[model samples]
Target: MNDADKKRLLREMIFYRRFEDRTFEAYMERKIGGFLHLYSGQEAVATGVLEKAVVGQGNKNDYVITGYRDHVHALKTGAPAKEVMAELYGKETGSSRGRGGSMHIFDPTQNFMGGYALVGQPFPLAAGLAMGCKHKKTNQIAICFLGDGANNQGTFHETMNMAKIWNLPVLFVCENNGYAIGTHIDRSTAVRDQYKRVAAYDMEASQHDGMDIDIVMEAAEKAIDFVRSGKGPYFLEFMTYRFRGHSMSDAKSYRTREEELEWEKRDPINIYSKRLIDAGLITQDDIKAMEREIDENMENEIIKFAEESPEPRVEDLTKYVLDDNPDPRWIGPLQK
Candidate 1:
């Protein structure tokens, strides 16, 4: 990578970290609601993989789908930060036009597909997308992002089998953060390492350190190349950790502070920032300036956009509903 790319990635990682932090504050202040999952520590996985997937693949977009922890993925896949923030605020200017808050961030024009609220939902949806591409003979592939717990879902195994049988061009990424909503993987998952589980389907797979952007990039470059080369599906497990609890409501009493602190030492933003500084690509002052700029943008642009955006009007609530042939019983009567 060039000096410029390194510096840009460093800035992006820092921006993502601050973005999640600000999101936590917004949730606390009641500016946002619903199941708020912050991508605080897992920035590198999304940053590295999404950025690398499009590199040298020309300007075409690869379809991306993920679970509820999706703000960062959406942003990386070309969803604007202001629109994401507005989505969280449930305003009319949101990516989903205020219909789906936090969980369902859909922007298909950018090929980000959508984030699913149901556990393991994206697994089959991604495979189906790949199947469509294969039928159409398009070079485009589907990228599926799911959590460690999601690996146990029946869809995970089902999709793996079908992808291999049909030779679908899909990449399944398991963000193994060591816990399934406070339950450690060791306790719930019999096979701890997620990549090893894909062997049941004879699929190619690997694991990598998700905290380091460079490592994640190197791993994703190979996986994405193999999948896009028409070699069928590839599975990658990123051993990452989320800094916050599963959701805004989670107290996280299940984990120890000592363990959290240990993971904090490997914080993705800090690691990337230090790497950029040590390589002389950027100075500590430059990093601070980057943070200041991001913070200001979050407050001035993103927050202002969400705050100033109009709330969805009550009369417009049924606009997107299936009213073309609506059932009278399900629809009932609207309030006057």
Candidate 2:
């Protein structure tokens, strides 16, 4: 890649890392409520994949959806940091108007479908979106992000079958962070290599180092290109780790401190920063400047926006709860 592209990627990765760190701090301070999931150690996966999937020329029509650990993805997919932070703060100015909380951020303008809380729900939803694009004869594709544990869901296999048979344009990304909540991948999954499972449906599939942004970008570009060319679905397994617990409340007793430290040694941001400096693409001063900029934005801009934003009023609680005009047949007894 060119120096410009490398610098752009580095800047974005750093922004996401800093943003996540600040978010965790906010959660700890009880500024943001509900279950909080931090995308701390797995920055490279989202940064690399999204750099190709959602940005630049020829990517305007793409759609993105992911599992609940979604703050970083929402931001990278073009949702403003202020709006995302507001969403976490349960402010009415949030992406979902404070209704979805941390997990269910949606911004249709950016074509970020949502951050679904259900384990593997995004799989079929992504396939449906792809099918819509196919029927409309648009080159648009859907990128579905799921966790390693979600791979075990029945919806995963069902979506794979439907996507292959119908030749839907979709990319199924499994961010395998080793553990699913308290359970490890070895114990939860029958086949350790998640990508190999895609072979059952005869779809294109591969694995890549999720810790390296460049490798992920390379793999993602190939997979996205194949899918956009109307070659059906592609499966990508990103082997990564989460530095924090599954959620803010997790004790993480299942893993050892040694294992955690070992992965920390391979910190994606530190490694990529070192690589950039060594290659003369960026200097220490450049890194420091970027860090300072991100910190200022988080403190002066994003947090203040959220804190000053209004909360949804109780009287208007049912406003966005249901559709304004729905088919009477589809409306259940509860609505009636």
Candidate 3:
């Protein structure tokens, strides 16, 4: 990518990082609710690929599907910050009708299928989407992002095999953050390099440094081109780290303070921001202004979503529970 593009991505990543950091504070103050998964240290993978420079609207189409660690992806995909925050706050104005909560943010307009909470659940769904694209004679492909621990699930293997045999246009990204909800990668798997495991299915696989935005963008561009050229599936293993705990309640006993600090030194947002400054593409004052703009916009969104929306009425609890058919009208009269 060019210098301007790089600076744009650096800004986006920083915005996402700061937004999530504020989200944690909001969660504590009861402004935001539910399980909030901070994409903290793994910002580059999402920002680098999703930036308008690397991936754009074209005949070489693309789609992104991933696990529940999804706020960054949602933001990068063009979902409005206010809409996402409102969704988390369970407001009617949320992207998911204030119904899906934290794990099910879906915006078809942005092509982000809902985030899946079940381990490895979205992989097969992603593969099927790619298969449909091939059948429809379309060039579009789907990108599936998952964690290292998700590789252990049987669904992961099944999806890989099907994707390869069918020659489905899909890119499987494994964010190898070293730990899965507390367990490290070495202890969790026999083959530590998870990308190599794709060899069993004869799929193309490679690795990239998830922290370096440029490297991640390069790898994404290459894989995206290869898939668009009718090459079957490709797997990219990004070695990254999450600065926050797995969830709001994590004790973080699996790693040390030194380890956390060491990773912090390689923080994607800071590293990329510094790179932009060093390259003379952006200034500290510009960054300050950007941060101020994002903070003010997000704060107003939170307040609006909260004050203007109502909690899901108790009688409407079963309104969206069905799959085949859903009843729009309330099942019974309002209790209150």
Tens-digit lDDT track of model 2 for 1-336:
788988888888888888888888999899999998889889999888888875433246488899899988888888888999999999999999999988999888888889988888999999998998889887888988888999888999999999999999999989999988889999998888999999999999999899988899899999999999988899999999999999999999999999999999988998899999999888999899999988998899999999999999999888865787787787755753
Model 3 regions lying over 4 Å from their true place: 52-61, 323-336
Candidate 3 clash pair list = none
**Selected candidate, larger lDDT, 1 vs 3:** 1
- Candidate 3 residue lDDT tens string, 176-243: 99998899878889988889999999999999899988889889888888886898999989989999
Off by over 4 Å in 1: 55-59, 323-336
lDDT tens readout by residue for model 1, 35-123? 89988999999999987775223236788999999998988888888998999999999999999999999887788889988877899
lDDT of each: 0.89, 0.89, 0.81
- Going through the candidates in the order shown, the clash numbers are 0, 0, 0
TM-score for predicted model 3 compared with the true structure? 0.90
TM-score for each of the candidates: 0.94, 0.94, 0.90
Q: State how far residue 23 of model 1 sits from its true place (Å).
A: 1.5
- Name the candidate, 1 or 3, with the larger TM-score value: 1
lDDT of 2 at 60: 66
The true-structure Cα RMSD of candidate 3 reads 4.7
